[model samples]
Target: MSSLAKQLTGVVANTRKLLDLCGSLQAENDMLKLEVQSLKVAVDTSIDKNKQLEEKVKALTVARSLDEVEVGEAGINEKILDTKQKINDFVREIDKCIELLK
Candidate 1:
């Protein structure tokens, strides 16, 4: 019965070690989850800032196009059409960026 007792003690010690390791892993997992949450928030903030910047760019493009429109008819029409295409391309790019983030 002495040998049996030693074997049981060993088993108990190993069980304790396993439990400790599991607890530490769980803690690390929780820390990683929090970090992921923070990173997601950061990404969201960056996306919002990018959207604001895009809006500013679009407005500036329009304003500049209008200023150039006073230069007269023939070439101004072409410039306006080019500006519209650029705006469309920018919109599509923003959509792609949003999809990538998601």
Candidate 2:
């Protein structure tokens, strides 16, 4: 009877230890799951912000292109004005030559 009692006591002690280990593992699992959820939320927010930033960059690129086109048009207009001035000068010279001949 004494030997049987010792065996039973050892078995009960081992069972308690196992139960404690299981409880600790369960708590750790819960904490890890919560952490994973938090990380997921943070990642999603970053993705959204990145998309918005990309859109803004695209809009800026388009605006810059439009500005370049406008500047080019202004340069073309200046060239046209210079050409018109030269033409006017030539006409004056032609009139002077005609008057002298007459």
Candidate 3:
């Protein structure tokens, strides 16, 4: 065989090998992307659960504060005002979170 023909054959073989390697890398990349997507889903689910827990905690805290106000004998009218203020603050915080999510 001619030297030029032999060189061309080597080049073609190398190209095929490179293509095969690229195909393999592409498949691996796709798999990694799928895994990342799954992880993101799980993370989002966890975040939602955390938000629910936080809401529950906030409710419990408000209930506890009301109970304290009752037992402390500070007066019902004052307790109502405090509760209203806390509720307003909570609403503002929720609005901030909504804006951030948007």
Of the candidates shown, which would achieve the greatest TM-score relative to the real structure? 3
The 0-to-1 C-alpha lDDT of every candidate, in the order given, reads 0.90, 0.79, 0.91
The estimated TM-scores of all candidates read 0.69, 0.66, 0.78
Off by over 4 Å in 1: 71-102
Residue 27 of candidate 3: its Cα lDDT?
Answer: 100
Candidate 2 clash total? Answer: 0
| Model 2 ranges off by over 4 Å | 71-102
Query: lDDT for model 1, on a 0 to 1 scale?
Result: 0.90
**What is candidate 3's lDDT per residue for 55-93, written digit by digit as tens?**
899889889878877544457778888889989999999
RMSD in angstroms, all models?
4.3, 23.2, 2.4
Order the numbered candidates by lDDT, best leading.
Answer: 3, 1, 2
Candidate 3 local Cα displacement, residue 63, angstroms: 1.0
Cα lDDT over the full model 3: 0.91
- Report the lDDT tens digits of candidate 1 across residue range 34-68: 99999999999999999899789888977787677
CA lDDT for candidate 2: 0.79
Worst 10 residues of 3 by lDDT: 68-77
Q: Model 3, 73: alpha-carbon shift in Å?
A: 5.4
lDDT for position 41 in model 3: 100
lDDT of 2 at 101: 91
